[model samples]
Target: MRLMALFAAFSLSVSAQSVTRAGLTVTYRDPADRGQLARVFTVWQKAAQDLKAKGLTLPPATLTASRNASDFASLTGYPAHIAAITLKGNIYTQRLAALHARNLLPYTLRHEAFNLAQPPDLPRWLAEGLARVFSGEAQKDPPERTGLETLSERELDTLLARASGLGLNRVYREATRRAAQRLKQQGWQETLTLTSR
Candidate 1:
């Protein structure tokens, strides 16, 4: 039991290197990625401002930039602990890279940060949609619309039929649309408050 406990402690220490900046903490394996870390800090700063504007409390956030796909999958296992984890190279990396090229990294970062702030019980649609909304990507482009608005009736039906096989992208789009509609009807503060329950 002592050996196992020691191993667990050592493993946790080796898994991540962290830095705190502007009230945001970032964890990663490579210390050389300081530039990327600063970028994440900027995103968090913007997100904090937006949340403050909405009169919402800013939850403590720790952004983790996973070294690779495997790391991302592992780090995200306990979603409640961290605010967000960005994979170095994965299926979505190509698309995310394009967004970065367009200087929209902050938007993506903000989206993930919003995910980190909310309770786990929050509905997928509301969580993802609010992320897009907070990130300022809700009205930007179709790719950014990861909520119900992006799906057609037929596609929605198919997704419903194969709920177990539903993709994360589809969830984001559907949630974005649903969240937008709710925001329109209920307003921001109430929408955020709903997540608590």
Candidate 2:
């Protein structure tokens, strides 16, 4: 059943973007409701400002709502895809917060903002890790374990078996220690560079 469901999703038809903003020189998908254009711009504009404060900005963003599975596949190449998929109600990432939600908007914008500030050609893990760092959720007492849980069950078991020798506190400390190192070495701009790739 799960396999069938995955296949169905993969074969779904995707719609392409039809409207392009000539004045701003940006691209957005053809919205079903034409009136939504203003709201779209408003949302994006506000998101841009929030991101700028976090040291990230999108020079111009291309927002699209694709129905095709291939369209989603193609988006793996873009940094904004972090927030882009979430713009659609159905495709939120398990590891990240929703982009449209009021509380999460700032973090989502900051993640994309870093993409805008850095050079492209970065590795996915590096970019995702850094984005999660500035995501604010990371700084709390218990960080979001989504990224860490991304490993397959088997992979996780392997890691856990190796880590079982250590106490829970020791393991957590090590994880944070490594995360801190990443923050110090790459910083924001460097991490963005890694993610944009």
Candidate 3:
């Protein structure tokens, strides 16, 4: 079925159930998810520390997980192919088990945390690019050629906001490359202060 049709077919809501450990709070609805927060708190800690060192200190944020992909897609209004999203300083994700099975749990945690903590006025393309770079996903991108560079910042942001699945991946890699280059040219603090008005 089509992605929008699939998203429109069902709707589910998240209930507030939470666990706090080592300065991190995780929210989830599944009974099976108990104790899983403890397992990943370290990743959050590391990402927080690393981002802080890079001049972006995060605020109080909760990492939330939906029990299944359908619920996640419905709640987030994003394609399930998208790993996670940050809204109002909270991270919402698909099932922890699914992310673990796919080895995306750590990267997702890091990436979304950056999104949560990023400067409020940061441009979308730069925000996404630096998020992946901060999460180390940028380093792992498979080399591929694309026309993304020719697009203006506004155009790139629009693409990043609308694309899903592989289309999202390509734009994301280009964004990462752009962000990394900018970071290299201007130091981290300078970049944040200059671009993140």
Q: What is the TM-score of each candidate against the true structure?
A: 0.62, 0.38, 0.86
lDDT (Cα, tens digit) per residue for candidate 3, span 1-197: 69876676443233557888656788887656665676578888898899889878777777778878888889888777667898766688988777877888888988987887788888989888888988888878987776688998888899988887778889998988888889999867776765643
Residue ranges of candidate 1 with Cα displaced over 4 Å:
1-16, 77-104, 119-121, 140-166, 194-197
- 66-154 in candidate 1: lDDT tens per residue? 55445545655533322344433111111223335567667767776666665556655566678788888777647554445656544
- TM-score for predicted model 3 compared with the true structure: 0.86
Model 3 bad stretches (over 4 Å): 1-17
lDDT-wise, the better of 1 and 3 is 3
User: Which segments of candidate 2 are over 4 A away from where they belong?
Assistant: 1-40, 54-57, 68-70, 74-110, 119-126, 133-197
* Candidate 2 lDDT over residue span 1-197, tens digit each: 99998887665422233344421222323233234445445545665665566566556544444332344446544333334333321222211112333355445544554444444454434433444554553565354343553454344334433553234333333344444566697665554444322
TM-score order, best first, reads 3, 1, 2
